[model samples]
Target: MTDRKLLLRVTLGWFLLLILAYLNHFQNGFHFDDSHTITYNTAIRNIKNVPAFFSDPTMFSANPQHHHLRPWVTTTLAVDYWLGGGLYPFFFHLSTFLVHIGLCLLLFSVYKEITGNALQHRWAPWIALFAAGVFGMHTAVAETINYVISRSDVWSTFFIVLSLFLFIRFPAKRKYGLYILAAVAGVFAKETVPVLLVLLFFYILFFEKNLSVAQLFTARHFKTVLGVVGRLLPLLLAVAIVQIYTLTRVNTETQDAGLSNPLISYWLTQTYVWFRYFITFFWPFHLSADTDLKVISDVSNWRIIVGVLFVMALLVSIVKTSARKETRPISFGLIWFAASLLPTSLLPFSEVMNDHRMYFAFTGLALAIVYAAGLLVIRRESSVVAHPSYKKAIIFAMALIIGLHAFGVHQRNKVWFTEETLWKDVTEKSPENGRGWMNYGLSLMSRGDYVSALKMFEKANTLLTDYSFLNINMAIANAGLKRNEEAVANFARAIMLAPNDYNSYAYYARYLVEQQKFAPAKEMAEKALSLNKNDIISLESAMAAYQGLQQWDKLKQTASYTLSIDPENTKAANYLAAAHQQKATVALPSSGLKTSEDYINLSLVLYNAGAYEDCIAACRNALALKPDNADAYNNICAAYNMLKQWDKAKEACKKALELNPNHANAPANLKWAENERL
Candidate 1:
């Protein structure tokens, strides 16, 4: 076959393999950070907000604590929202997968260039193909592809590789600033793109100038090194300008990006994290969405010592290989791997390590591993190289490796299939991670398994006492189980822990609205809205409060404002219509309640409205009509508890429980009343 036909067939094969490997992940639901950025974020609900995404950092997330200046990420999310007509996980995952394909294609071009430069063997193209295939189908990359928000890592890495490709493939375009422009675009996608400057500097040194790593330190090549630095000054200046602009424009104060570990310990932990990242590139079986790894505060710890030695070994290998032209690609790839990790290692992010972080570093590791293997094949004697069986063995080995990685990717897709699967996997793999357990509880709560959810929340509480989100989830689970006093206490604790976080206030408002406390619900909703005006949940809560209180004017205003922000909100539209239909004074029914169920329903309405006395009287009337009415006794018990009549509340609760052993609220009310009496 001609070279063009061969290349075409190989590229087609790669595409098919990638599709098969990731097919299961296309419909995978959003996980973790996707909640704040896509699910609840109202800004991306409207395409008109795309322009605001670039100018306002807060447009990145509904949660103020997560806001950052990734305008390109937000812009793509907005476009996906527009195309999908809502927050469809398929559209988001499709966009991310397409970007992954683009990144893999770029990786092919980059690997080909570096491989051709290192070894002028006829198999350079095939080696590049193998490297690209390994990276494209690798399980580590699957973590990033499956995560919608981690597309920032993929996009930024794509631009970095694109910049390198342009610089290598089209030297003439350097003067036109195409490569630098790619780097600039990457900066908007993610702040880690600045590492491209270091990458480019090393590329020019190894490939362009054909300089060895040792020559830079020798007196003979000092001028040559200076000239390389001089050539990089323009790119450096551009990167610096964009980085400074990002730093100044982003609201760092609002972001809760800091690690809980002390600075020294965090840095030390990263040393071990690098070791973990390195091993996972080769053996990805231990990947976790949330790791239970902790900081290494002790400098003398064995893991820290081993990690330091591992890093030293890698640096030594890079230096040793850089001294030879045949191994320059290996050295350069190692440098790429190390440089890619520098930003995350030096900075103290909330997470010490993440599986998706391998997306960038593994690109270079693939090149190194493939090129080193190719070198072994070429260095073999002519008899061995020409042996048909040997070639078959080599091909089979390559196919097996790629096939295993593809299979691993498919399996990880199953793990990421839904919130329950994902968090359940985390709870298993990272059992010590309180956040993981809490998130699993949230999934159970979402499915209305409050009893099981509370068990998970209680387990999480033992691990993460001060974690505000955990407290909020605990409050929600308690309320779901009808443990009213415990729920109230958890809500107060959550607010106390994270006073500035709007989620606590918004969730509390929702609970209050459910309990028919319209005034307090409205107040909490307004407070949450003040923190984040674009929060749709808070707006809905406020509308519910207004409707419950029969404040038609305020309900109309809140619903109108919500509709203005989200034009396709059917709930807001319904609320606005309800407000229009409501009259200032509606006449009550002229006839008195005759059926037991009717009196019981009236008691529930009165109980929710805080008219405890009236609620108890209605419940008594329901009992008079139907002596065996368990719901009436339950209502009376709830009303008495609300009124702080503990003895009466306990008596009524016991009677309700006696009539209906499965009475959900009776046992909780009885327990509360008994505790209060003590």
Candidate 2:
């Protein structure tokens, strides 16, 4: 086959296999970060917000506090939204898949270029195909592909690879503009793009036949080093300025809170983290959306010691092997792997280890493996082919490795199929992970399995202690279980811990309304609205409080506002209906017994206020003028029921039935009164 035809076949095979592996994931809903960055981000709802996305970090999400400067990521989401007209998972997943395929094709091209020019000219196309295959099918990449938000990682990889390709193709000073463009685009996608500079440096060092490492450190090579730096200075400065701007725009409060662990401890923890990352690339069985890795303060810990030795061994091996012309690719691949991992390992992130972090770094590992395999089949003479037996064995080995990785990728997609499955797997794999248990509880709560959800939250608490959101979730579960006091206290604690989170106040307000604490519920709901005016939950909570307080005007206004924003909101629709009904009921009995309607309304207001006896007296006044009024008798019965005056309730129900035998609520009231009569 011609080189072009081979490339086409390999690219198609990569896409087809990738589609089959992640076929089930097209319908998967948004997970953790997707909620904040995509689902709730109202700014991306319209294409008009595109300019705002560039100007303000807050426009990246609905949460004003979640400041992200990744305008490219948000712009892409806006494009998706514009194309699909809303939050469609299929479109998002499809876009991500396309980007992955692009990355794979790019990888194949770069590999073919590198391998074809090597000292031992092997079947370069085959080497490129297998390397790209390994990377495209690596199970660790499942997190990045399935997660719509982690497209940031994918986007960064696309630019990083493109920039390297450009640099490799055009290493002269004049063609640096295209390289700078790719790097800048990458920086907009993610801050880690600056590492491309180091990558370019390495590529120039090993591939360009420039100054070798030994000579560069001595005085004689100082001028050579200066020449290289001068050539790349413009590209380096552009990336550095972009990095600085990106850093300044980050929300420091969130960053500091996430990196609460001391810097030294975080650095030490990454030693073992690198070890975990390496094994996952090859074996890839142990994977979780979230992991519970502990910090290793003790340098003598077994895992840390092993990690140290592994790094030392890898460096020594790469150096020793680099003398052989055939092993240069392996040497460069090792360096690339170490360099790619440097940013995530050295920096303190909220997570100790994230599978998506391996997305870019895995390419280097794949390169090393593929090049080593090529060595087994490639003859020393550029024109000669290897023996059939050696070729067959090498091909079989490559097939087996790629097959395992493909299987893992397919299985891993199932874990990311839903929030429930993802978190459940996390809990099972890392039982001590508090966030995993908490997220699992949230998934259960979404399914309305409150009892089970409560158990998960309680388990999470045992491990995580007092995170504000955890407390908020616990409060929600308690409210579900009718553990009112505990729910209220937990909500209060959540508010105290993270006073600015609108969700805590909104949920607490709803719980307060359930407990008939209308005053506090109204207060909390207003506070929640103050925090996030567009919060639908907070709007609903405030409307519920208004309904309970019989504040018809406020209820009508709040409900209408909610309905205008979300026309499909059932709660807002119900609230609006009740408000209108109450308003009409208040304006009733225009002549003889107008006082009765007024008194009935007063009785309801008093009943909501928990003044049961006062409500009963008001009902009696309504009954005085309109002795046969069914609503008056029904109101009296409801007040008596509230006071547990069952006999009185039974008598009132009897009168209501005598006045209007088919009164809507009379039979149920009579049954309840009879059952509990004392």
Candidate 3:
């Protein structure tokens, strides 16, 4: 077959394989960072927030600690939210699926550029196909593909490859502008683009001329080297400008402990981490959504020794292979792996190893494996398609390898099916990880398994103490279990640990309301609202606390504010009606109130005063003023019930229930009227 036709056909095959491998993931729930980054992130609720996403660093995450200038990533998430209706995981997963496909296609384009030169542009399509397919199916990338927030990695790598493709496909002055723009976009996508500068330089030094550093300096290719460096200077300068901006934002908002380990210790531990990265590419049997891998404190550890030797051997092999004309692609692939990992290796994050970190680097590993196979076939002195047996063997091996990766991808996605399943996997795989246990406990709490959740929280606390949210969750579990004293202590501790955390305060307020501590609960709820005005949980707590305190006006105001934010909120509607009802029932007969706020409130007062006809007339007035007022429907229900109008009362109550499913008294009132005799 012609190369063009082969390329198209193989690309189509890779896409089909990707679909089959990832289609199941479309139903996967949001896990880990998805909660803070996408689920609770208010910025994604409106596309109008897109501009703020660029201007406000905190727009990217619900958690202030995660604030940074990842506007492109946040903007895409906002697009997903607008498309999905709201927090429906389908659109988020679909976006991730599409991104993976895009990365695969870009991988094909990049490999075609890199290998087209090395393989005389003959077997370039097949090599490109192999590399893209393997990388796309590799289990190491599943975390990025399944977790919606990890699009930072996806987009960054996409633009990095795109920049490289542009530079390779169009090296002229006109195309350089577009290339530089892509490089800049990549920097905004993630902090990994600076490494692209080195990758571009190495590409020119190795594949473009098929020469080593020694050969380039041997007088023949010195000017060529200088020319490549001069060409890359503009792109490097652009990346540098972005890096300064990104670093400033990251440093400003970074609330996490700067480095969990010393710089030298973290650097030394990356030796084994790189080895682990390599194993994941070839055999990803030990993939986990969350890992608790330890940092290597001692350089003389056996694993570090083996890892260093393994790395040295790979570097030596790359150097040896680059001397041969047919083996330069393999050398480039090995170098690509190390270069891609350079950014993560240089910095120490909270986690020593993260599977998402391998998403881009694994591309290099896949390339090396595919190109090495291609080189073996070439070394056999046979045309790629001439030797039927050799070609069949290579095809079979490729299918087997690709099939393994596909199976792993499919299995890995299943673990990400829900928060419970994912965290359960984390706890099982990394038992010592406090965060994993805590998240698992949260999942349990969400499931209403409060007793079990408390146990898990207790276990997690042994490993990690002083996390404010953890204490809040533990308090919630205690409240659920009816351990009021324990609940109060934990709630107080949570508030002390994180006074600014609205959730901690809100949940504490909820617990206090349950204990009938109305005044304190109201105070906590108000504090929570002050911290975050849009916090719906705090708003709900405030409404509940006002109801418990018998502060009818405050309850009505809080409920009205909540309903303005979410017009369909049943709980707020219930609170609003209950507040008016309580105020009407408790007012003195001799009270000389001048005017009601609305006809609904007047009807409520008249109904309580036993003026049934007047109450009915007032409700009619309310309905005339505001036709769909659920509170008016509920007030009429109460008035009809008082007048022994069974059928009328039942009808009004049903209407109220239809308008506000959360009207707490409507169902009972309707049932009472339905059972009454005519």
* Top-TM-score candidate index: 1
> Candidate 3, residues 1-678: lDDT per residue as tens digits?
887887788668767877898878988988887887887676777677787776677677766567778888988888987787577888988887787788788888888877777778466678778888888887778878998788888999889888878887776743438978988988877888887887788888887666874586677788888898997888888899887886576535344434667788787788888988887777787878788887888888998897788888888988887787667777777887888888878878667888898988887778888888776766674565677887787778888888887778888889999889999999998998888999999999998999999989999999889888889889888888888889889988988988777778888877777777888888988998887665667787788878877888888788767754443344665666667676423433232112222555656655765657656765775575467777777777777888888889989998999899998888888887888834
- Which has the greatest lDDT? 1
- How many pairs of residues collide in each model? 0, 0, 0
lDDT score for candidate 2 against the true structure: 0.78
Candidate 1 lDDT over 346-389, as tens digits, reads 87777788888889999888988788888888787475667988
* Candidate 2 structure quality by residue, lDDT tens digits, 1-678: 887787677668667777787788888889998997888676676576787776578767666566778999999998997677577888888898899989987888787766665644437777878888889988788889998989999999899998877777665744639978898989988878877877777666566654344554779867767777787788899998887887687666543335556678778778778878888876687788888887778888898887887788778766755655556677777777878888877767767888888888888878887787677556443333345665566657766776676777778778888889999999998887999999999999998899999899899999988789999999888888888888889988998988878878988888887788888999999999887776777888898889888998898789767754443354664566567566423322233223567667656755665657656765776776578789888878887887888998999999999989999998898888888873
TM-scores for candidates 1 onward, in order: 0.84, 0.79, 0.80
Could you tell which candidate, 1 or 2, scores higher by lDDT?
1
Candidate 2 ranges beyond 4 A from true positions: 1-7, 171-176, 251-257, 321-326, 379-387, 513-517, 543-678
Better of 1 and 3 by lDDT: 1
Evaluate residue 192 in candidate 3 and report its C-alpha lDDT on the 0 to 100 scale.
Answer: 89
